[model samples]
Target: SNLVYDWVKAAILFGVVNTVACLDHLDPPQPPKCITALYVFAETHFDRGINDWLCKYVYDHVGGEHSAVIPELAATVATFAITTLWLGPCDIVYLWSFLNCFGLNFELWVQKLAEWGPLARIEASLSVQMSRRVRALFGALNFWAIIMYNLVSLNSLEFTELVARRLLLTGFPQTTLAVLFVTYCGVQLVKERERTLALEEEQRQDKEKLE
Candidate 1:
């Protein structure tokens, strides 16, 4: 509905302003209390109810046989969500910038995903053997695009450019090292996959010879 769209738009604007302001504090886990506040605000004014998405995408995914993966996935989802609302447009400009900002963290977290749970280990091991086509399919970058849009879209509003310029002065330079480290983490994940596949093939052929 158009109303829904308008609400989303409003929520995005509010989120961007909030995020830029919070950059100075930058607390770990972003303080659950803060997130809760945003959730309430979005729900009340913007109609972006957390319950719907939380139930559909997040609820069923956590706390059970697959519980171990929950922490990592939840963290990733939170980071993704915050960036989406804060960045403001779900566009490419913010997407790349956000990635560069947290790419290293993402790379490490992705690696952590490979080890975080029984399911995670199985998935990572399978990924190592899976075809590049399958990998590409799973690598859908829309999540990233949304975050960028959120960030850049906010720039359309008053004072956004002023805030971004300030962020650039401090956040950008510091994040450079993080970016390089994350890039290295990505390479490590690739190498780890290759090693697993090579080992898997060796064992398969050995079994075949014996049988």
Candidate 2:
């Protein structure tokens, strides 16, 4: 029903579902189907809108690449602000890229901007710088949110512990590798010490026997 209440609920659900899905696909230790489903939901539902804005706002800014801050922010802020301000029931604030959902190609934008006018160059440079910083900022926030959500949501199903255990398991191969290296070093050390001790004992016996 394009009703205000329904639209708001859909908007909120859309944000959560998309962010979770993106995070699930991030590589290495992944989440369950339920979690992955959220990602699918997000991409299918929201990506079109995002990509639409990408086509409109991003493609032109850096000459076919939405790599710079001006274009990236223009898209992110515009979409985010619009969703929050109008698309939902209540005013909710969230960054959609927190789930590793979006990546901006800053280098491409800069390369394209390399031959622009002074003002265009300045704007492009600043946008690139700002985009880098914003990426880091959103990443940190996403991590914090993940930690918080896992702590709360994993209790009944032990989902949090599962993730932690997976992290440990993923390290097992590397840890075993380091252990093997250390054991080799220890064995060499022991052999060297034994050789020195044996040589010393032999010298002492020779001296005593000679005397």
Candidate 3:
């Protein structure tokens, strides 16, 4: 699992660097093509890696003790993967901005770590505290910076025109599929949350009776 995570991270970082480098040397059409390919590659590997890890975790831990949440969690992860896979290159800025603003990726990682045994729980606790401090220190400033940068770049006539052409040429179907998947996943997530809360409450009431 660690090996897979490390390799995926390395691939994404490398892809980002290569894409930027290509922009400097490649011609207009060639660079976009190259970037599109890299984007597909990164998103594919990233989603698969995450899914694999989650499955492994479920099999190891949740499969025995918390089986009830498996379907919901799997659906949520699947939705996330599908949405990311279909997002056009133009959507990367928005994705990055959202992640920066909420630190969703970081929070997810910490949550997973907390599910692990004792040592990982310690790490997860520390991570939560550190994340809170980091957010307190820089979250607002970083969020605004990301928002402004993306807004400026996306608002440009050239960029907007490029995105429009890309969408017309290749992004429409992918975007539509992503929206449908997200809607389905959102419903699943809500149902899962309610179910989990009810189960927790039931367990609490039973414990009170026992006491």
Candidate 4:
């Protein structure tokens, strides 16, 4: 995957750096702490590298931000496709690159949408619960989209079989939603715990300064 998706290398680099930082005092890997290591190494692939650089510097200006959504999506996807072709062609490298671009750009598109002045007034038309529910559902959908992106890059399965698997998985939307809801709850709990820990640490530092 590091060879196929440049982002993987960035994540492994991130993990190794953190591992080394904690090497001095952390407990030894018992039961291998395999799950923790996997969590650290698996998720750090948000890096964009040169592919998205071209998107920002080259294609994004072709129509400016004011362009129609479809054309804009095409131009952005094409930027990565062409970049992959420029690098080299093996088997549907451009296709994965297009998928990769789509995955990356979805976040950007949402950010742009949020920044749109009219979106505030439009969001006002919806109830808070409705908006939150819709956003949470979209989060689950996006998670599946990302699963497809990762599966494509893994390049282990035939394209047709991968499509079949995705079709099979879609039948379990409820399962995905349940998993996402549980994950969200855990994340919120962890975030709150971290916030409290950080506040306590800051207070300790202040007390030390006063002493």
lDDT winner among the candidates?
A: 4
Q: Any residue pairs clashing in model 3, and if so which?
A: none
Question: Which whole-number lDDT from 0 to 100 does residue 163 have in model 3?
Answer: 47
Scored by lDDT, model 2 comes in at 0.43
RMSD of 1: 17.4
Best by TM-score: 4
Q: What is the descending lDDT order?
A: 4, 1, 3, 2
Q: What does candidate 3's lDDT look like per residue over 82-188, in tens digits?
A: 44454543555445334432333333444455567995655566776564443333333333233333333335535544544553456678864464354444434
92-204: candidate 4 lDDT, tens digit per residue: 66666767666656665785797688986777788976665555555555544555564665554476365645555865787555766764454444445656999999999
* Candidate 4 weakest lDDT stretch, 10 residues: 33-42
TM-score of each: 0.24, 0.26, 0.20, 0.50
**lDDT tens digits, residues 104-187, model 2?**
333334445654788456556677546444333433333333433334322423554565455447578785456435544443
Q: Which RMSD does model 4 reach against the true structure?
A: 8.5
Ten-residue stretch with the least lDDT total in model 2: 33-42
Write candidate 1's Cα lDDT for 1-211 as tens digits.
2334554566666567668767876432221221111211112123234434543465334422323444545544554564456546555545543453354245445546655688566665675446443333333232222223334443342344454455345477776445434434443455456679999999999999999
What's the CA RMSD for each of the models? 17.4, 23.6, 19.9, 8.5
List candidate 1 stretches off by more than 4 Å: 1-46, 58-71, 74-90, 93-149, 156-162, 167-211
Cand. 2 TM to true fold: 0.26
